[model samples]
Target: MTTTAPASGAHAAGSAAPGDEPLLEISDLDITFTTSTGHVNAVRGANLTVYPGQTVAIVGESGSGKSTTAMSIARLLPPNGKVTGGTIRFGGKDITKVRNREILALRGSEIGLVPQDPMSNLNPLWKVGFQIREALAANGVAQGAQAKRRTVALLEEAGLPDAERRAGQYPHEYSGGMRQRALIAMGLAARPRLLIADEPTSALDVTVQQQILDHLDTLTGELGTAVLLITHDLGLAAERAQHLVVMYKGQVVESGPALELLQKPQHPYTRRLIAAAPSLASRRLVSVKERAEVVEQARTTAHAEAPATTGSIPRSASDTIVSVEGLTKVFPIRGSVPWKSTPFTAVDDVSFDLRRGTTTAIVGESGSGKSTVAQMVLKLLEPTSGRVLFEGRDITEIKGRDLLALRRRVQPIFQNPYGTLDPTFSIYRTIEEPLRLHGIGNAKSREAKVRDLLEKVSLPASMLQRYPNELSGGQRQRIAIARALALDPEVVVCDEAVSALDVLVQAQVLQLLNDLQAQLGLSYIFITHDLAVVRQIADHTLVMERGRVVEQGDTETVFHSPQQEYTKRLLGAIPGGSIPLAGSETIEVEVDTELGVDAEAEEIAERDGARSPLGEEPTDPFTGAGHV
Candidate 1:
């Protein structure tokens, strides 16, 4: 899209319309990091601009220079990095050459920055009230009680609950989603002319992500400030950003209006990304191939069958992987006053059952204690009261090896792969560690099995040697899945597993999980606030709020007819609320091979590299037999 516009609603390339000469101007930017290994070009010859009141998106995978370019513009690059070439003029002043002292003054005032992880920006020792006011005071906006009042107002404006009381708490007291909101409040505390967000919602729950995006749209809509949204989520960028720039490695591959580019992508990478985005539709669970023709088109066609819904769930015998009865975690509100006895129950009496072969997703908003439940389930927290049943056994009383066994069975996949996946380990070692520890296999077998596991997650075995930093976001997640699946555990606790992934990558991972569950009879405790995901994979549903199960039922029942007001609000929060489920998309496919019926299973085993039981290796995974 052209940066220049006409007079009535017009803007210029490096400048805006008369009386609106663009909020930021950037050109021929080049960022370099002087590493011990030598110079690394983190960003190369980038060009971008944010107008007076427009949002522009820079989309790319990790290490593609999107974040590097944005950080350089804000002069917030890592110490080793520098703006080697380029001129960044914000409101007509050259930011690249500006003095370090003056740069701080310009920051949070002329331009504000919201880093990827809000938690990193906040200090636990300091009250959020002080942090919020710090930005305001730095810009000479206000000080003392006046700044405090303004901070509270901004928090309220950002849609945070109990604004005044929450302002008194530290960052650790807030949930992942709420912390992000507070960070937004701090960023907008100074009412800067331009705000640059680098994956602002990267680690937040889906519902919270939507809320934050909505708040941003509203806040910016009223303030009429320019926003530069840097993200890897094409779907998200499409919704929030007016224009889009697709970066690859250190160069821009495509640039156009967001919708226009998304609807019809020019780059192959972009096309793959869009085509891969997760759908609201149910995923097919079966993986046995039948014929070559069907196998060729199966990627878009396979539909896994629903689980056996035969007998009533036994009160005792029927397998129950996990159960929480009236579980609550509370923190005493400590103050200088000795007599104060106020308490905040972050997770209040939350209870649910996790079946052995089904998926149950917990959906909710920020501060809803969705994650607290996960932490509690992980035994990372001592529940203030109530019992956590595991395999019909109470786990709270059990510790040491018992707890270790529970952890091995119910593994977690965090939102941020950059943080969650160990950077020091190779994909092979990461996946193999569990297998080796759980005594699944010996060294040679483990290495071979690691390759097989990687293939199951749709990754190449070659990547086994590469470290976490070398892989893509989707790849690292696949490795995470491989590591989780290594032990062949009865249950996998995917706490926001695909939350941070881009749409396409998320769809692929979801499909992989579906495939894995069906093949291995694996159960999932899929904790998330994304209703769309709940509808797609959850056989059962649990709607959580303030640490309580407001509603729990079958997936279809929860999605189609919610009995609780909270459930209805959650369902409504979904972006395209309640789209019909009985439609299909069409795409042409071509196949070269025609395998005989008998050879199909063997073909699939060999191709996919899936292991057949403990010691046996299967045939190709793409055998024609699995398709039909």
Candidate 2:
């Protein structure tokens, strides 16, 4: 394999000067897809360049042509997609007009790709080691025992623990972060000159994401490979890339140094993106005065509305709506022996309380058992041991008509809007199904209710006729929220609800939730891995690790002066946490010192320095397993 010289520039580390000839450059690039309607232009005269050993990022929302542009460089666009205009030069060669044979040869050996979703990208039928070996053999890197040896080395370099054992496992057996690392290992199997990582760590925890990026940085540096990172996260882009390319509606709105663009974004769309990111928002909770005002608003609104003749009304803040005590869920793992299985504890004695009209967020990395606890509280799964009290009644024993009532009172907005909403149902029908099932009103009244719900979510009534496939990710999520509210649920369980949305859309959806809470006196059980999100909306927080609540307290107290080492590490891993922004001098103040923990508690927490349940290894803070 060959490599290009390092980028030259006056800017900070990793950036290239514009005067230098770029290793890969796209000029006046245009891409279009043949849709059922007509030819849809996905990329419009987009221009970008990547210098040797430089890290450049393309930041934009969905449908902004970021992925389309990256795919065009590798000739990996979908069947319906085609490059109509422009020149794509790679290493002084025009790849656009290259023959099919040449294009195939140039892909893995010269330019590698790490797709968005590891689960979908990886072949489920094959072991991870076999896949890496195949990539090596295809690229003429190695074969036989030599290839197997190289595969283990790649896995180890990608930061997977026990690489020899993990390589023999299927994709489903590994955690999400581990799967992503496997994908990265495969992408780097051939040691290509350029690596295109598309939304590489969007679904990963902050700590895991940081670790993956750090590994990528280290390996790419050793190999002198240029990196073109495509993502929707501005913070990640700012933290990792030297140059930032801002895209909007298939056009390049702005391109410059990462810090410059972040500190003082010149484009209107770029400004909007930064403003909408919760991770970039103020870290501290609302002041006491502000919270009081919000509570007053909710009280006035609730009083003005007619009292519910049926169903439950909103309780006061002091009232505990849901109490989880000694919650434990143990799943039996079957071994090779017939009818022999060992118990694997998923949730181990976790406990928390959800106060009325308040938000209690459960946060941790994937496989931390946060979802299991949530399922128990929502009565979707029965706890192996412990009790869940909803309105002073044990939900486990509730059945028949009473259980149905619980379902109406506690609705759920799942993580994947695409999967949760039925494709066959129209937006109006989707929202009306819950109302009809509950026998809330007549046909005309149900139709009116759907419209009201849409309006509440800041969606237009015209969208009522559209199907799930016809809407954007943000729009589909809103429809899901509308459906959840159609039954007038008091406690809405949001399970990774905003994880898939773009920064701007995520901010809108979060604000919508807050507004609805204040207006309807609704409480929430928000489960997510993004601590930045937890800080923005949660009043109280429960930090989970290995099926147990390692730390629990008010959001401000936990964030400002965390007692646990795991909590401190989690807080420190936030992207751009230490990077100085243009307008903002400091990251959002997570707690007011005056109201925060006293000196005594801080000393005790430091002295204790409790070890994490997962482990105390210096690997990814999200996953305790260290790099081999």
Candidate 3:
């Protein structure tokens, strides 16, 4: 791995060969932020080079300075931050010292950006087409009818179907993936020479993510646009970028061809990332019969030793903890005429059984009915038809004390920990409130329970006094988990729980969930669009699309042999499935250890005066143990 050295001299005219002339270059870049506490070095001596018509990715964990480095290229750093050193050259000219007017002119026309969080980036009040047209007019590309015509074309080019109709819809009306496509349309509206994408597909479902990347790649390839992609997903980076730049703390740790660097990572941090990635983990699910056979053979060979166990043995029908029969949900799509509406089926005949102390994952793209099914199971939504049997009791008709009792038994851990946690409340109150609501124990007992819950989640009891905003994303999520367990629920419904976290943090949370499940004998309804995560955490998998379950089986069967094209597409869209990982050998990753076994996480936790559930000399993150 080698750093991209600074190039010298005047800008060359016409087209240049690959690596001959840089399109976007940052050399010895130092970015600083002035805070009331003191000065923070956001970026330190960072060096990155993006060549013409090439896709280069900067990979790192959250707060690793990759986004800051990319934002500096467009002079989009926040008011408190400034580039204190080094040069940012675009097409062989230093742009760091360029005036605001020049920057305004250079932006959109010469350099465009597709930022993360499409919902926040787009204006809710404006129509999608209007936003694209606004970009066109601002960049002096076109105006009025010409811009309007171009806007529709841009949307269509970005892969949105029925672009003309979609143009009239606001950001909120569009699905998450659609809003992202519109942003891509706006970014490329001016046909810039370079485009900076900051975690562009981080929030999207796997299939949608693949589509967005494919569209970006196609458009950029045809337009000869250079891309500077900033992302935390190493698998995504490896699959999409020709060259990969690994950033850590505030500097580049490794840089080279994506495949070479991924296959043979030199840096310990890079190796740790590869080891922690669920995308690189085994996708195969060993059949129950085969596993049983192996377990029996091992036990016989032991000759009076303890019985050998197979991972996640299929539970008998009598052990079914929760069963959904003919579950269906419908919503009415109302227009201006209040009395008239169209019936929209959100979930249709979804049925599955969650075995005791096992994980069942529901996976699909956005608006694919996965979340709806989860909501129904959580008793948060009333299904139009069918029943949810919890321990052989129908929960749909329960009310008052019975409903409250049901709620106490089945709790939820949502995706956004910050959103779910009350900012004004301390972690103690947040966790204890559930106990108070359910009248679980006395004041002293509730306090003790909260502390015990925190320890169970691998968080310190010291966190009890802190507010939501004071904790990191991962910490806050852990707090959420602790709160969910305060009532000692038998069933935990995790709605896209780890999807919003960094890969390393995601691994930790998944591991924590598995550990908690093992200790508490809890059953989980894990809802997510991330197949990689399902592969790691789920014993049984259900594939949903267009309000119906297209496939359902053990995780291994679904991944190894899918009967539905939709299921196959979802698996195929998973990033880095084609890229040979650092270790080709498959290791059975035990359910309890999962992502929590990351050595890097343990090291960071120890260094930070915290602790990771890094029990038993960290096992190979690639291995799995049977669910006990």
Whole-model lDDT per candidate? 0.70, 0.80, 0.79
The alpha-carbon lDDT assigned to residue 505 of candidate 1 equals 59
TM-score top scorer: 2
TM-score of 1: 0.71
What would the per-residue lDDT of candidate 3 be over residues 1-628, giving only the tens digit for each residue? 3444323321222134633778788889999999999999988888877778778889998988999999888889999999999999998999999898988898999999999998799988888888899899999999999998998899999999999999999899888889999999999999999999999999898998999999899999899898889898898888988888888888888777788777777777777677567776543333344333432443233233221112222222456768999999999999889999999999999999987667799999889999999898988899999899886778877777667777777899999977999886667778788888776667667767876887787766445555788787888898899888887777899999999898878877986776676566677899999888887778899999999999999988898899999999999999888887544564333333343323433554455553222221212223543110
- Which candidate comes out best when scored by lDDT? 2
Model 3 residue runs over 4 Å out of place are 1-19, 283-317, 586-628
Clashing pairs in 2: none
- 193-292: candidate 1 lDDT, tens digit per residue: 8999989987776667778888988897788778899987676677777677878778777777666665556577666555443332222212122112
**In candidate 3, which residue pairs get closer than 3 Å at backbone N, Cα or C atoms, i.e. clash?**
285-556, 311-626, 588-623, 588-624, 589-623, 589-624, 590-624, 590-625
Residues 1-628, model 2: lDDT tens digits:
1111122342345644455567788888999999999999999888887888889999888888999999999999999999999999999888999998898898889999899997688899999999999999999999999999999999999988899999999999988889899988888888898999999998789888888899999999889889999998887788899888888889888887788777877667777666555556544234434455554665465445533424343333446778999999999999999699999999999988987778899999888999998899889899999999887778888887777788888899999989999886666668888887777887668767877887687665556555788777877888899899988877899999999898867877887787888889887999998888888778889999999999999988988889999888788778767657754733232222121222333443365443321132223234544321
Ranking of candidates on TM-score, top first: 2, 3, 1
